[model samples]
Target: MSKVALVTGVGRRIGIAAAIAERLGNDGWDIAFNYWQPYDERMPWGRDAESRAELVRRLDRAGVRSLAVEADLEDAGAAEAIFERVGAELGAVGALVLSHAESVDSGLLDTTVESFDRHFAVNTRASWLLIREFGRRFTGEHGSGRVIALTSDHTVGNLPYGASKGALDRITLAAAHELAQLGITANVINPGPVDTGWMGPELIDTMVGLTPLGRLGTPADVANLAGFLCSPEGGWINGQLLYSNGGAK
Candidate 1:
């Protein structure tokens, strides 16, 4: 069997998760992707169930085996279920791409206990559990294990959202150090201000002006970086937060 990659939050067609899955599929990896339809429905850019089915078709066209898992990461048992399903269906996972997030916007004072917990459950707690499970199931004989997480720098009004992802970054970095002996590389990619249907026209224009590259980031841009980091060439890069945001700083 070919190597497998497990990517989360791939409910939408025009999403970073989908792009990353496609890139890995093209690079000779079968895909086992996870998505929560309800989460996508609650977001600004809504996603339909058909989109998930279509993504599977696209991956099939790319000549790679594909499996779509419908799961909600807010559930505590989600991480284990994801790994188990992928393992049962695709043999073993060689790469894990964490692109799922709860994108609720709220200030420090406005953030409710429920909201904070939800974000933490999905973004922080679930991520660490997924990484832990991957490490446990990883086998060096198949190939080096790759863990790539998508993160952002929005810590202003997005208190819980940003803070939760911050925890994910820290744990991912720690995983890089702890798992290096097993040939597993852990890294976070901060794709700043990506225009994945969330940004309005004015917001996109303002971000474009702020970016040194004079353009907003596309999903493909993030996918390319993820592809490189999961490849053999990226074996030496570990425990680092690499920014792929068109020089936004």
Candidate 2:
């Protein structure tokens, strides 16, 4: 099997996507990551230009090849472009980790049409397109292809983001069967309440109190599971939504 992986939404060093990329690189997989700075800049936790560069340096120091592609997943053509660039730069991707999202806190009564459409375009449509490209271009050995997506179930105040992620879950799980001929295992992971610089002090305390582990989930926690799922040992765990949420109720 080719030891190449494509990880999306790696725009921040503290983000889950960056952690997953680093973990896979440490596991000896050549890493190709996609990021959009504009998304981070607009978010409450602004962008860190140096962090992106530092992540690439870290991957390079791991003795594995690393490529960073700046992509706006909202563009319909970005999926194919990412695959083409990664294939030419590294090799055919054997594992795909989708950690990107278009999240904005808007309730059902307040969510606008534009916001809803953008959420689906990035979270749902882009995922489908990327997976489709992966299935079409995959040349890995039988039972070598892997697909994993990060998901959420928090929908009370975050309507569009949560709803689109639900669609993403279905689209990803379907690949486990639809792409079975290509020997791919697909699954969704709901890594609940990972702070990743988004939660405040009070929210952190509340989350810790709620979790059975007495602490909020970290990016590394999710990364560990993702790395395992991409390994050969994870081939049997397919078409399921596994929660790595520190037993948060």
The lDDT per prediction is: 0.90, 0.95
lDDT value for model 1:
0.90
Residue 97 in model 2: lDDT = 99
- Which one is best on TM-score? 2
* Predicted candidate 2 versus true structure: per-residue lDDT over 1-249, tens digit per residue: 459999999989999999999999999999999999999999999988886789889998999999999999999999999999999989999999999999999998999999999999999999999999999999999998999999999799999999999999999989999999999999999999998999999999999999998999999999999999998898899999999998999
